[model samples]
Every structure is written in C-alpha cells, then in structure tokens.
Target: MNPNPLKILVLYYSQHGGTQNLARQIARGIESVAGCEAVLRTVPKVSAVCEAVESDIPAAGAPYCSAEDLKTCAALALGSPTRFGNMAAAMKYFLDGTVAQWLGGELIGKPATVFTSAGSLHGGQESTLLTMMLPLLHHGMIISGVPFSEAALGQTRSGGTPYGASHMAGAEGRPELSSHEQQTAFAQGRRLAELAVKLAV
Candidate 1:
C-alpha cells in the first residue's frame, strides 16, 4: 500500500447483500488505480422503534462509517438497496446525520458516485441511485456515472445504467451480480478514482 494513498470511501447500506456485492466491485475498481485505496464502510440498520440500539460494530461485513471517513476521503461511492423507488432508510438516515459535515464543507468538491440494487428489473434502481445523490449534491460533491462509452452500459440487459451501476437481484434478493453489472460497476469505480487523482493533483 502507498503510505499516503488517496482514499476513496465506499459507503453503503445493504439489506440482502445485493448492494454490498456491487460495492465490493466498485472498491476493486478503485484499488486498481495506483496510489488509490478503497475504504469500505457500511451504515447500521435503522429500526422503527426509536429505542432500538445496534451494536457498536456489525456482526459481519464492513464496519460502520465514521465522520472521520467522510472528512478524510478523497472521493466517495455510495450504494443502497432500493426501497419504494428510493434509497433504503438506513442510508438516508446516515446521510441525514451528516449535517455537521455539510456545514463544515467536508465533502465539497470530492468526486462521488452512486449505485443500487433492486428486486426487479424495473424496480426503481435508477430512482434509488438518484435519491442517493441528493445528499452528495448538497455537500457540493462532483458526481460521476457510468458513461455510455463503457461497453457494458450498452450491453447490459439487466442493471447497467448511465445514472450509475446497479443490479437486479430478483425477488429472492440474490447477491450475485450479472457480468455486465460487474463490468459497469468496475468501470464506474475506476472512473471516479481517476477523477479523484486528477482533482487531488
């Protein structure tokens, strides 16, 4: 690892692992760039009851994201499983709590990207991705998406979109990604990292 590599934070909320799978592919793409490192973090589940409390650390998967992660990262990639044509409440909850970072301009000008997974092909993946970008835009982040130049964008029959990388997990909420979905995700990550490197310079 480069001692002072550029850090690209990959933050997400996954209910059935589909979004998490997409996040891993994006992280791989980010790490492919020299002097760039991917930091994977996740938001804890939100409960309907206000009294419900989650453990400090998750039982599995990436650890919870911290304010320091937002402050220090050179770039960001956010993902979430789709819910009613929007991002999961857990992710929305996490972003809602970042008012301090917004006030401090912590993420301003950083390159950012969004991704999502839905149970059906038309199950609001694009809408979910768009909803995830709202907070990033409020923070003054530069958002990137999968360009049509990526061959997978044209080839994907299931989940690839110009809005961002996405996956169709079917009703079962499977985690496995289609080949095109993976390719588009990797391309999106690499693009974000490359942009971050250039902007950092």
Candidate 2:
C-alpha cells in the first residue's frame, strides 16, 4: 500500500448478500489506486416495533461502522438495497445518526459515491442511488457517478446507469451481476479512489 494512502470507507447494508456483493466489488476498485485503500464496514438492521438490538460486533464479515470510521476516511462509497426507489430504512437510520459528524463538518469536502441493488430491471436502482447521496450532500461531501466514458454504461442491457453503480437482483435476487454491470462497478470504484487521491494531494 502507498504510504499515507487515502482511506475510502465502503459502508453499506446488505440483506441476503446482494448489496454485500456489490460492496466487495467496489472495494476492489478502491484498492486499485496506488495511494488508496478500502475499509469495508456494515450497519446492523433496525426493527419496526422494538428498539434495534445488535451485539457489540457482527458475527461475521467486516466490523460494524462507527462515527470514527467516517472521520478517518478520505472518501466514501455508500450502498443499500432499493426500497421503493429509496435507500433501505436501516441505512437511512444509520445516516440519520450522523448529525454529530455533520455538525463537526467531518465529512464535508470528501469525495463520495453511491450504489444500489434492485429486484428487477426497473426496480428503482438509479433513484435509490441518488437518494442515498442526499444525506452525504447535506454533509457537504462531493458526489460522483458512472460517466459514459465507461462503455459498460452504454452496452449494459441489465443494470448500468449514469447515476451510479447498480445491479439487477431479479426475484429472490437470483441472477448474477451482468458483465457490464460488474465492469461499471469496478470502473466506479476506480474513479472514486482516483479522485480521492487527487483531492487529498
């Protein structure tokens, strides 16, 4: 790793592994940068009736994210499943708790990105991605999208968009990410990581 590499936080909520899968790919993109690294973290679920209950740490996978994680990262890539063209409640709940960081301007001016998974070809991927950025914007974080310079955006018949990285989950989240969608995600990560490094300098 490059000394003093930019640390990009890959924070997300994944249910049934769909969003988690996307998170891994995005992390790969971040690590490709010479002076940047990806830190994978997750948020616990929220309950409707009862207060959210979670252990001190997740049983498996990356550690649970803390506000300190936000402070340390040079850039961010947030992910969540599509909930009626919006971010999942759990992810939103987590972001809502970041007002302390917002007040401190911790994430302001950081380059950031977003991604999502939808159950169908038209299942609100782009909108969910854009909505995910709203909180980040309020924190003054810069946003990035998949530009057309990536051919995958033009060629993908499945889930590729100018809004951000996305994947089609189909019913039960069956189908795998199409090649174009995968490439688009990798391209997004690479772009954001590169941007983070440039901005850091």
Q: Score every model by TM-score.
A: 0.97, 0.95
lDDT (10s digit) by residue, model 2, range 1-201: 467778899998987777787788889988888888899999887886424457768889889899889999999999999999999988999999998999999999999999988898999988899888899999999999889999999898888788888888889885367788789888889999999988887
Highest-TM-score candidate: 1
Model 2 regions more than 4 Å off: 48-52
Error of 2 at 152 (Å): 0.6
**lDDT, residue 92, candidate 2:** 94
Highest lDDT: give the candidate number.
1
The sequence of per-residue lDDT tens digits that candidate 1 reaches over residues 44-132 is 88876632767888999999999999999999999998899999888888999999999999999999999999999999988888888
lDDT of each: 0.93, 0.88
Candidate 2: minimum summed lDDT over ten consecutive residues — where?
47-56
